[model samples]
Target: MNQKIKRTATKSVTGVLLSIIIFSFSGVHLPVLDSTADSYFKESITKAGVSYGVCRIINATVSVIKESSLEVEPAGIGLSLAIGQIVDPINDMVERLSNVLVMSITSLGVQELVYEISVTLVPSIMAVVLLLLSLLVWLENDRLVKVQNVLINILIIASIARFCLPISSIANQFLQEHFFEDKIVKANAELARGTVDLGQLNDVQLPKYDGIIGTIENGTSYLKQKTIDFKKAIEITIENNGLIIETLLRLTFLYLGIFIIQVLVLPLLIFWFMIKIVNILFTSAALTAV
Candidate 1:
């Protein structure tokens, strides 16, 4: 009894410390994302025959915009470059990239590890406690054990879901807010305004901006069409990124969740195994006394 009490106390203390650490550590990695995107930005903006990296990202982004109207999180800039999955789901390369990148690409990989584990500790320890308590009475009160186990499982699920779901949602929302949401709207509006301005330009004024002049002599049809096309392309780019970022964030969080479940399950299973042994031994001893 004394040993069990000590162990429980230790677990409680550890859980408290861990929860505090996680609370302090879960800052959003938003700022570094622009740095990550800058890697592609330079490539995309440069002259032709420049970096294939820009083309690669642009292609993916364009595709994404064509597919969805949802926003991209700013920090989820990684997702903007991401492509493939939903359109392809299992068969698509995007799905593979999204999953692969979750661990491989984000700063979240190394940094979030400690925090995620920390967040998981309380629920994990609590899970062990519940399981052990359930085990002791499990054989004697089968109905009670079953009910308690179900409740514990629910708590475990709820805890893990709460932990992961928010992280994923935040990542998705972040990308949407920063990169995709207003970007598409702004880009579309600009393209439309550019069209109207070009239309209103007296034939005399079209030659003022070289780029505009070049586009105009090519005629409004060509200029406006290209503008719309390019705008849509950029929009797609933003959309693709959102999806991939969301996926990566989701996958990243799920891994930690699985870890929490394992921690809870393994200890619970061990305790139950021990309980079975104790029940068996007690039954034998009682018979002998009889």
Candidate 2:
């Protein structure tokens, strides 16, 4: 009789406390957590935009180089073919990178939408109703215990679903700040420099003479100057090829890291851990009841 009384009191207290918490949570927005998530989401969008912009600029520069013929000889020897060979692969990679950025942005937007819906009053009220049902089942005989467990499970899942993304977003932002910030900055810098270099390469043009005699009079000087300019352009292109390739690799790795953490790894891990904790708690409660 005394054990039964103690269990009843404990259940009552737990139910009241949970009810208060649920009511409070439903009535109020968690400003700190919400703001943090919003800030992180905005920052992620900005980064993706900047990356996309840089990629477009590079693509445009490469397109210009590929389309414009750089005649280095009178007999139709041009560097456009060589530029195309060098740039076609890089352009393809840039297009893929742009796609990835778009996907990342979309992922972030979806996450934000889910989070907004989860934290709204309707979900909170539903969770509260589930909690109340679980409490009522708790007060009943052991025959209804399984029903109570199901209600509790649903409640736990609802809670986790409501809050997991915001927590994960906070953690993702923290991880990015600690691990990826410096490297991303460096990668952006290198990409910007490479863009400028490619633009300069595109600007290198061979001087034109008026007519054949003028061409003949200045042919020697013209050939020498044009040769020097063409050689310089080739040198710039070769140098920029390695730099741009390295920078793109760095950006790809960094973005992949962010995507994995923000979209996949952290949220899944948190969800699994929360579910595990719920199972353990329920198992303990069951054992106590037995």
Candidate 3:
């Protein structure tokens, strides 16, 4: 009699819980969660856009340097060639960063789409149907127990898949805000400043020679001043080269960090944890049913 009463109480509780699950999935929306997810999605999109813009600026600066005839002759014969060697790798890196940013934006867009679909009537209806079927099987005999377990597992997976991306976005956003935001901002600023300085170097023009008569008239002083100018130009080129390389490295690492966190690491971790939870829930449910 005690066992019977306990079984009755367990069934009653399970029924109530199943009813609540069905109702939650019956086209009901949680405004707060949706709004928060939307906010995070927008913030991610904005950051990606800014990063891509910075990448374009870097590319443009590199292009200007590559196209300019910035030769400091005599003492700086291979100065432009050296700058080119330094910039070529950075150009490749910027191109790769742009591609990654584009992919990040696309992934965010896909996540938003998935979030929208998950909240709509279709998936909600499917979930409601699945819950009802599982509840019915729960009340029935053990003949269809395997089918019931399969349905439960499917529901669990579907639930996880439906909500994982939005939750991952929230997690990613929190990490970026607390950890990477300052570093990203500083790196972007440094890249911008470095690019501007690099572009200015292209404006350093070669001295114009008037004629042989005018050249002979100011020959000694002209040679001395020209040599000084050439040396100064070389120094500026070396300084800018160092600045560009350092900032480029910083920006590259920053971008890699963002990409890994937002796209790869967080999502995989969240999905794995969700799967673990599903396994625990499934095992407990099976044990209770037995």
Candidate 4:
């Protein structure tokens, strides 16, 4: 009966994972497989180059979206990060609790906590799966099966943090820059006005006027006639934006920190903890050594 129950649980989990895989890939462009896949969307976009025509096109599309005369998309990028946090083993509990509280109050009634719960639930399930994988791996290992299972669990807990940090950083960046949209529009308008400021219209140096013969009026008129597209000030999402560029640069260090946590800190911590536990359990120098 116990074996049957375990098999049922395993099948259910497999079914759920398969569903998630289908959803993640749904509508995703793959040039080799789908007619809907645009050459650019199907292509890898690490950098701009002659062969990377797709990346260049991507850059152009982003420019259009960001600089849209229409209202911004209200899809709420922070929501995605919230989902990521729930899956994360190393969540900043304090911050999450605050978001949850605010979300609850604003939502109220049936809607309250529904969306929050939806995103947070995904990570929670993923964490359980990872934990189970850790347990199974430990049980199958013979060298220190009984003694170091707890250590393996700890390492698993620490390693999941790798996926969570990227999500949180993405969320945090969106939250910081969402308000800046207004400021960006206003700044672009001001820049446009300043460039077309009619006071210096005669200062422009045209083909007919040069070598100290340029007037302020000439300069102003010259600029007005120039075919610069000031309306297209914004051109990319946060991922490809200058506003989030500095924040992303800092996140580069955070990536290194995760690597350290995974490759060095986690291993050292698990080793030290297991050594102490093993010493206590076996109560013999020879056993601990072996």
Per lDDT, the best of the predicted structures is 2
True-structure lDDT of candidate 3: 0.71
lDDT (C-alpha, whole model) for all candidates: 0.41, 0.77, 0.71, 0.35
lDDT of 3 by residue, 1-290 (tens): 69866775676567556656665765455576666778888887897789789889889888887666454443344655666776787788788778877887888787777777777644564556465563564355685776766666667776776667778877877887898778878867877777776676576554555576866787687677866765675576567667666765676676677777777788789989999987888689889999
**Residue 266 lDDT in model 1?**
37
The TM-score obtained by model 1 is: 0.25
The true-versus-predicted C-alpha distance at residue 118 of model 4, in Å, is 21
Off by over 4 Å in 2: 1-28, 70-75, 121-128, 131-147, 207-214
**Ranking of all predicted structures according to TM-score, beginning with the best and ending with the worst:** 2, 3, 1, 4
Candidate 3, run of 10 with poorest lDDT: 68-77
lDDT of 4 by residue, 1-290 (tens): 69866875675566456546534543343343222112211221111111123222323433333333122213234432332332222123222332432332232222213323323444455445444543454243575554445544443443333223223323323432453324433433432333233112223221333335554546765645531322122111221233223322333333333334422354356446655664565567557788
Instruction: Give lDDT tens digits, candidate 2, residues 1-290.
Output: 79887887777667666666676666455788778888888888887788889999999999878766545233235555666677776787788778778888888888888777777763666557555664674466685776666666777788888778878888988987888877888888889998898887667666664577877877587778877887788888888888898788778877877788778889899889888987898799989999
Residue 277's lDDT in candidate 1: 62
Q: 1 or 3: which has the higher TM-score?
A: 3
Reference-based lDDT, residue 42, model 1: 31
What lDDT tens digits, residue by residue, belong to model 1 across residues 111-203? 235334534454455545454543443234777667766655554553443244234434433453465445434433443333233222111
What are the per-model numbers of colliding residue pairs? Answer: 22, 0, 0, 18
Q: What is the C-alpha RMSD of each candidate to the true structure, in Å?
A: 17.8, 3.7, 4.9, 20.6
Off by over 4 Å in 4: 1-143, 146-166, 198-290
